[model samples]
Target: MNFEHSDKVKELIAKLEAFMDAHIYPVERDYYDFVHDHSNLWKEWPKMEALKDKAKAEGLWNLFLPHEYGEFSPGLTNLEYAPLAEIMGRVPWSSQVFNCSAPDTGNMEVLARYGTPEQQKRWLRPLLNGEIRSAYVMTEPQVASSDATNLELTILPDGDDYVLNGRKWWISNARHPRCDLFLVMGKTLPNNPRHSQHSTIIVPRDTPGVKIVRSQTIFGSLNSPGGESELRFENVRVPKANMILGEGRGFEIAQGRLGPGRIHHCMRSIGQAQRALEVMSRRADNRVAFGKKLSDQSSIRQDVARSFCEIEMARLLTLKAADQMDRYGNKVAKDLIAAIKVVAPQMAQTVADRGIQIHGGMGVSDDTPIAYFLTLNRYLRLADGPDEVHMSQLGKQKIREYNAMKARPAESRP
Candidate 1:
């Protein structure tokens, strides 16, 4: 398939890259310093707010939304948006400036796709305007979360309302001061078949009995504004109108939500790997050891070459997945999505490791972004579904196909 970027995509990429160079990259230090100086780490950093306002005014806002929302976005196709996502990936936190951050992007998609008019007006509108942020609450503390149907949270029917009770951790963006809503999943009918029992409902953050138990940490970083959090819902109540789609359709919604989310992560990860390779190559070229440039060392050269090859492979696979989604729908592209989900994180992690090795002690420290990059990429192995889980599913599917072929008559078989 032809994967060339269209003229429109190229223009958007140029705009995004220029925006990053002019604003984001230069302020990385200042942004960190501002957060460190602020006593309430959860509060929005001033520099981020300023940049967000600038980005919104410049019409670079909400580039992630594909479906038409009147005048809200350009509604670019999935393939068209992939390269732009790569540019945003160069700076991990910069996607939010253009209102394209995760969890929020996925949540917005849910509302846009399934929410009623009332739901859209109440939540989706503000989200499109960048007035607030939201989170997804699905994983639980007591289960093997890889199998989402194993989730044991309950959404009980009460007179004219539903009461939610569960414990969820790794609820990203929940700790952000501006995060005021959640798209929560729980079993609405425990007696139903496993996949058909769960449902998703929108719950406001301030509803009674909803508690933010504490912020969870990733590799000891607690000061992050989008800090992962553990939430407890003890009889938290919301109107029945909060249900999206209908009861017993949570799995369907999740499938649609995660298809886009997974590819978006891959696109950004290509950029992360690209940045790491840049750092590694520059270091190898200029750093001298034992009277020779590191670039002259055989091991260093091999790593650089390998990193380049791996990044290209991952990027092409990701683009192919995007194209399949555009042409055949997400269900038709499930295998491709799982493949890239496995490939991209490993590629980024490998590139980050090589960058760290080239930088020596400086890489492991906060002096460079390598350590953070490594941490983020490594966690992605378990993000949507773990590598092992995807591999298992893919393996089973292949085995089924092989068995079916073997069972066929000789003329019908290959």
Candidate 2:
């Protein structure tokens, strides 16, 4: 229960914050200007590689990978990585600068955990080096993707290759200029048990029959560079070696991957909310309304207090989830993972909304990150799984858990 960070984690946090203040915070607006320009669609910011090189040289690279990968990982646990993630989360695009962005982080974990040595040599090496990016193609336009068993994409065996055919949407990183591959999930064994029917296979983005239909927008912005996209796989094929953990193992890899990823997202959401709260407080203190500062108003004071309390609550919950995952395992910590997944995003969204109100007109504009924070947190509710889905599963688990306790002798329960 002790959430005190180890000496190593504290040192890393100090270094990370110093890096962000010196580099990321200074250029935040310039980075946004480059990405938001219509002419810069799908183009990397000119300075991204240099920033990444600096981060790597400073030993800040691959901070998201918790498991030991020899020299690839810094040998930190999930609990240790939480504060670092919160630091990166303050800037949405800054994670990639340190090779800690999502889709890639989750993909790297899969390769490290499940990919063959050859697969690791080809894909994982480049990803860890930050030479390329990747996409996790799972959701679909035709089915309710939240229920992954309802996935309609097909991956059928054909001699030495697996042929894939279907449509996928809301895929992050598909439009990245350096995106090299996709870890696609689809039905590979239809007649198997419900949970065992799906398989994950690596598909090179340049593979034949792979087509990007169009980039999807978040609130009218392209979310440029790493655009969410809809992709079509018409007889796309890859070698059998690309199959990860063999048939009927997609769900297994997914379960393992998502536990850490969910906590990471929550950690980042806390950062975003924290930033919003600070921005709101500053605006309230400085802005005058009706001949008085907004900070002097009782309503504004209440909002500031509530946001501060909620951010702390979410941050602690995320740390507890990270601690549970590190000490126990993803399965043992599933309930807490689900709880934080539902709570953190909603908390961030609420805090951001309040910040937006406090900022008045400036909040809705790109002048600050508050608007994007609201959007990101809102979509996160549907990303890993919907709020209702987690609540339902958690409810069932709690009911079963309490019922088992009830069936035990009263003395034994105590």
Candidate 3:
């Protein structure tokens, strides 16, 4: 199979890499400093705003949306977008500068695919323009959310409006000052079949009874501009027009939304792992331990070598999933997506762990980004679907294949 990226994609990659070096990488410290110095920690960083404006002006905005958006689209196939995603991912916060951050990207896809015309005019337009941010409220504290159908949130019809009552955690981007919307998933018909009972609705953040209970920290550090949040919806109300693609379609929308979202995470994790490897290699070559540089030691060399191999494998698998999504559609690529979701985070964690080990004590410190990278990658292992969940799904698919083959005619099977 042809694996080479198109010329257009290559050109964009060069531009994006240069943008990261010239703008993002240089301001990483300033961005953090701005956040730390500001009292409104949940507010957007001014430096980030400047950088985003510059990136948008340079035509680097919204690179994640596929061709379906028409004039504003990235026009790149999933394979073509892989390298660009990797570049954007090298720095954890850099994705938002180009308006390609998650939760928002996934939410935008839902709006583009399922939102009514009125819904698009109000939410999708601003989202595409990056005028405001949004959040996906799906996971609940009381449920094993990996099985999404187990969600217990309720959206009951109240005359011409729907009243929402639920508690959701890990609601990313909801804490941002500019976050004006929420795509909430809950059950509208609890007694119906598990999957068919749920629906996703658009709930404006300012709606009465919608409260941001608290911001959740990741390993004690609060991610700025938006971190995970705990939210409470006590009779939160929205108009009937707010339901996306009608009632009982939450699972369908979620499947479509997560297909691209999960793969994007995998693509970005490769970049994170690659960056970690780069740092590890540099540290190993320069740092002396027991009378020799770490690079000269057998253990360090083996780790670097194995990390390189693993990162490459994960990248290839991620690209394959993306390509499959592009060619065969997201549903058809489910197995590949599940495989990469399981593989990429573990690959990233291994690379990050090696980097930490190579850096000795400094790896665990904020003195280097390795610690943050490690934490971020670790969260990914559980974020989309835990490794165990994906593994089980993959195993089930394999068993189904084997059973189908066994039932086939003898000649055909042979």
Prediction-by-prediction clash tally: 0, 0, 0
Arrange candidates by lDDT, descending.
Answer: 2, 3, 1
| Alpha carbon lDDT at 404, candidate 2 | 82
Cα RMSDs, all models: 2.4, 2.4, 2.3
| Residues 138-206, model 3: lDDT tens digits | 999999999999998899999999999989999998888889999999999988899999999999999
Residue pairs in candidate 3 whose N, alpha carbon or C atoms collide under 3 angstroms: none
Best by lDDT: 2
lDDT of 1 by residue, 316-341 (tens): 99989988887888899898999999
The TM-score measured for candidate 1 stands at 0.95
174-252 per-residue lDDT for model 2 (tens digits):
9999999999999999999999999999999999999999999887878889999999999999999999999879999
TM-score winner between candidates 2 and 3:
2
Sort the candidates on TM-score, descending order. Answer: 2, 3, 1
How far in Å is the alpha carbon of 330 misplaced in model 3?
0.3
Question: What local distance difference test score does each model get?
Answer: 0.88, 0.92, 0.89
On TM-score, the leading prediction is 2
Better of 1 and 2 by lDDT: 2
- TM-scores vs. true structure, each candidate: 0.95, 0.97, 0.96
The local distance difference test score of model 1 is: 0.88
